[model samples]
Target chain A: MKKSILITGGARSGKSALAERLALSRSGRAVYIATAEARDDEMRDRIAQHRARRGAGWTDHEAPLDLVGTLDATDGDAPRLVDCLTLWLTNLMLSGADWRAAGTALAEALPRQTAPVVLVTNEVGSGIVPDNRLAREFRDAAGWLNQTIATACDEVYLSVAGCPLKVKPDDVSL
Target chain B: MKKSILITGGARSGKSALAERLALSRSGRAVYIATAEARDDEMRDRIAQHRARRGAGWTDHEAPLDLVGTLDATDGDAPRLVDCLTLWLTNLMLSGADWRAAGTALAEALPRQTAPVVLVTNEVGSGIVPDNRLAREFRDAAGWLNQTIATACDEVYLSVAGCPLKVKPDDVSL
Candidate 1:
């Protein structure tokens, strides 16, 4: 059976760990799709931490901002873990690719996947209003991206303070 | 009078033209906040086209994702044009910056801008639904960003195929 789940939460809320753990629950050659760019020490540390936690024997793919192409390149029923969508969108936006082209590329690519997918993203909507125009734009985009992914996934989870709350059922009998 | 307007549209839909035209209407200086990263020849051409149009006497600042800093750095009552937000957001995401932190920063910075700000962005929500996980996320983020900017701006315009339509009114009184 084809299964897809979306995992999201606040920063340092353990969303990535939880998504990886969930992907490991099923037995297969799990693939990790990392979208983050190591632009600083802190980010490098975070990426290292995720890498260390995942350990060996996992196929790691660093396809920043090209999720659709990466998804299409992979072969098998193995569970695919897209580390996060927030950074992926960021990469695309910075590369001068309009949001619609990115979205169209992404929306058109999801249905062709032959494996169960687990996607991770940041939950940023519930917060104080941003101060600058660009920040507000990011918040709006992140919120909208989360909603779109949640709508497409069969199950959705909200992680806060390292705790996971299932917003959708994981019933396999359906 | 300090006037701020956010311009949004699809790719190559004359957003830059509208933004430059709007910025020229004001005094002080015209500051261009460019968010694009020239990844290829096409992007280079696009950026060149915009730069060529701006002509001489325009100070160009490349603030890919640091909107707050850009806004803060500019001294009083100057006319500023943020060429686009879509690319800026992508830069932030790829750089591993927390979406909320970045959003908060931008939101806080806009109101303090002394210039009549003309912000440009792409409207990506009207397109076909995203099929893949990554594209869907981008679509959602772009939609939210537009909504947030429209809400924050005194005036908003939606550009389609090089034609401009006023979606919001100018709040600055002469």
Candidate 2:
């Protein structure tokens, strides 16, 4: 069976970079599933930077809100790397999409894929509680999303300071 | 030799709870050094909740600032759990204290302690980049602080969804 790996860490903790590296390590074609939308200049710049970093050799798919559908459509032979889930959550919240339904769809769709999948998610629960309601809601939703996705994954890694620590399978040799 | 353990996680990922549990697991007195200040009703209620949760067998020390002095004065035989370093960072930022210097002081003081210490900290770098400079600065400072403290500590665990993942001593069995 193809394996699903989840990589989580704080901002700029080299999570996405690690995910990219993992995707490249696998055989066959690589697919990059980008969940970020270029809503502003900063975001646009960040997306551009990511594109530059990934270089050539990977297919890019922008599915800010249609993650399940995109994953369903990808070729089974190609390994898929979902760069992040937090921004997808933000997009869902902003678009007024039902989080539970989207999360359910993601959970149900993941196992159906034939290709190996590597997911990158932000571990946002270790910080101070946000002062605003929206931020708090996002934090809670993100936490739920991470837990749900992590449960479905065959391997989970918590990235810190550019190091990847295998979290799941609890006894796996790193 | 006394051991210093650093526990890091996102907002409500059970980092503090795990630290508290660790403190309770050890023999001797448990000292909880709280860094939060009850500046508002919300904060006061949160503090009250923590107090109620800890309940009875622990010594509480409120040190929004002067963490070094408080640690210096604590009984050497008791286990000390600083149920977070992030808020202390906020307090320092608000009070115009030098974060680098304070972090250096903490790094220096932790090794000299006689009692086993468990420090809870937020892994704030994994989220979306804050839109403002101050928040960005805080994120960078917090990351640096975690790295510095983790370097000095004997053990490091990254908490997530109430589960503790041992990160340091890479070969130790979890």
Candidate 3:
């Protein structure tokens, strides 16, 4: 049976770094699933920086949409790290994709995968209520998506100031 | 020595409720400190809703800018629950208050207070980098404030979907 880890934190909270560390800890071919699209210069630069930081040992897969499909296409034996669910949510929302359906599909597919998977997501619901409708909707959807993914994962961790705090496996000593 | 508790979470993540619950659990008078200023109808409604939810058994104190002064004026024996630090930060920013200086003052005052303090603060750093400079600045300031308060508090909790996960006292069993 494969293990699924959900790592959630704020921007620059070291969530992706933690996920990468976890993925590297596993013994197998590691694949980095990039959910962000370089839609603008800053985003493009961010993508470049992430790529440069990862350096040399992993296979990269881009899945701005059809995340479930991309995961399905990857070799089952390879350990996979999905860089983020937040960006994927944004992609879905911007592209007019059915977020609910996409979320459901991803949830269903996660358990069926043969490889150990580490997912990184942002915990965006802890901020002030956004004044704009789009931001508010995004926050709600992200929160719901996070809760759904967390429920499906074997272990869940919330990162703060680069520290990973185990939230799942609730019985485990903190 | 009086205890200080920091409750941090996303918007609608139940940080305030958790803070209130903790304050009520304590054996003493409870004072509610609200930092939000109703500049618009929607904000007014929100303030009204929060006020309605927290009815009776509590004295309400409004401190949009003078948080430290207001806190000082309150009865020192009463356990005070500050509804949030995010709004207070907003108030400070809008009023051109020096956030760094204000934060330092807060840090200094919290320890000297005789009353137990339960603070609610939003974790705004967990989301995507905001597009505008002001929003980005706000996120950074909020993050810094949270970290500062968390360090000072005897207990710090990160709430997610209404679940309170203890972050401070790093070694104790949860």
Candidate 4:
């Protein structure tokens, strides 16, 4: 049976780093899927820092929101780490896909994989509400995405200020 | 100034017909963004029909793929057509969204004001896809979404047999 883990938190909340640490502890090669698009200088710096942190022990895959394809491509001996799903969803929504179309796609794609997938995402809904319609739409999507992946995962963890709290997918459930 | 036209086609070859006829008479839209998620036998038939007949009105909106937000959602009265972008980008590839927080957000938000937006989307793209992985992904995203809005439209027409003959749209782009 295929197993998966979903890690979620807000920006600068150490979600990615926590996911990486968990992935490294697993007994297999680590595959990292980076989803953020460096559209500006700040993002560029962020991406660089992430790359440096990984430190050559990873095979990095660059797919903005094409997770299914990325997962398919990395189907081998490894514990797959999807650095983030929030940015990936943003890429897809901005790509002109309706939420229904986007949501069903991800939900259906998860069950077909054999490798253990560890996903990371931001908790955007934990703060102030967005004023624009699009931002609100994106926020809603992010929450739904976290729920969808969490349901499919063997473990679900939420990080806050650098601590990990297990939510679902208990050993008994597995 | 950049111009766009939205095309609505069917399984055999209806969408292109409508799109082409409409494009032949431009109505001053921004750019044509396709939003179909091709995933099944029906979708394959529809995509084949569209590819065989596509001409003129195909402008690439590669980035910010979501037509509703990426384009200028204005508060004025200028006609714009996002020809068949809904079907072209299909939702299978889409991944992040929360619909409860933004249910029918596009319908509520897009048609709210004076901007004349003509969107063309296939009534299909959701259903069975003969067990093919990628094809199934596509069909799951496309459904009767476009047909729902055709009723609210000032003019709606269906194409049967190959013909660009049936023409409809309020403001011509000539």
> For all the predictions, what are the DockQ values?
0.02, 0.18, 0.20, 0.01
* Candidate 3 residue lDDT tens string, B60-167: 889988888988898467789898899899899988999889988898888888888889988777555677887888888888998888878888877764556877
Q: lDDT tens string, model 2, A128-147?
A: 45658777768878887887
> Which stretches in model 2 have alpha-carbon errors above 4 Å?
A1-122, A125-131, A144-165, A169-174, B171-174
What would the per-residue lDDT of candidate 4 be over residues B72-153, giving only the tens digit for each residue? 5433444444545343344324544432222244555554545555566543342223355555434344433444455345
**DockQ for candidate 4:** 0.01
Better of 2 and 3 by DockQ: 3
Q: How high is the lDDT of residue B160 in model 3?
A: 67
Tens digit of per-residue lDDT, candidate 2, span B1-174: 237999998876767777888887766359999999989886787689788878777988988989889998994788899978999999999999998899999999988888888899988776566778778888899999999999999988877654578778677575
How does model 2 do on interface RMSD, in angstroms? Answer: 4.8
Better of 3 and 4 by TM-score: 3
Give the C-alpha miss distance for residue B129 in model 4, angstroms: 49
C-alpha positional error of residue A14 in candidate 3 after TM-score superposition, expressed in Å:
1.8
**Compared with the true structure, what per-residue lDDT tens digits does model 4 show for residues A19-91?**
8887777663489888888999998999999989877568888888677888888977677888778788888
lDDT of each: 0.72, 0.83, 0.81, 0.57
Highest TM-score among the candidates is held by which one?
2
Alpha carbon lDDT at A81, candidate 4 = 88
Q: Mind sharing the TM-score for model 4?
A: 0.48
Ranking by TM-score: 2, 3, 1, 4
Candidate order by DockQ, decreasing, is 3, 2, 1, 4
Candidate 1 lDDT over residue span A1-174, tens digit each: 347778876678888888878877778458999999899999999899989988865898997877888888874878889988889878877887786567556655666677888888875543333345676667556655665566567777767688986655532110
Q: Among these predicted structures, which one has the highest DockQ? A: 3
lDDT of prediction 3: 0.81
Clashes of 3: 8
